[model samples]
Target: MGEAIIFKLHLVLGTTIFLLFPFTRLVHIFSGVAAPVKYILRRGYQIVRKRT
Candidate 1:
């Protein structure tokens, strides 16, 4: 039936989007947070070395 075909198409589109998400900027918004974490880690290391 037409409804079944529409359902299958929706599933395919949703799956395709899910598979592509990691390569999209929508994912970058999450990964971008790591930059500050890296900076904080490096800053802490520097502080620890400077104190010793």
Candidate 2:
């Protein structure tokens, strides 16, 4: 019976974090980690034209 109570508490906390993850600053952590990999994988250098 005690183990079931602990399991329920874990489920509640996990659901809360999952729901709140997008609105919180915690999301920046994922973008910061992914940005470098995305840049590295992107194709081609940006073209810049000089004014005549």
Candidate 2 TM-score, true structure as reference: 0.52
Model 2 misplaced stretches (Cα beyond 4 Å):
1-3, 34-52
| Candidate that scores best on lDDT | 2
Clashing pairs in 2: none
What lDDT does the true structure give each of the candidates?
0.69, 0.78
Candidates in order: C-alpha RMSD to true structure: 9.6, 8.8
Model 2, position 4, has a per-residue lDDT of 88
Error of 2 at 23 (Å): 0.6
lDDT of 2 by residue, 1-52 (tens): 2578889999999999999989974564566768767756767778999999
Candidate 1: segments with Cα more than 4 A from true spot = 1-3, 31-52
Candidate 1 accuracy as lDDT: 0.69
> The CA-based lDDT of model 2 is what?
0.78
Question: Model 1 — which ten-residue stretch has the worst lDDT?
Answer: 43-52
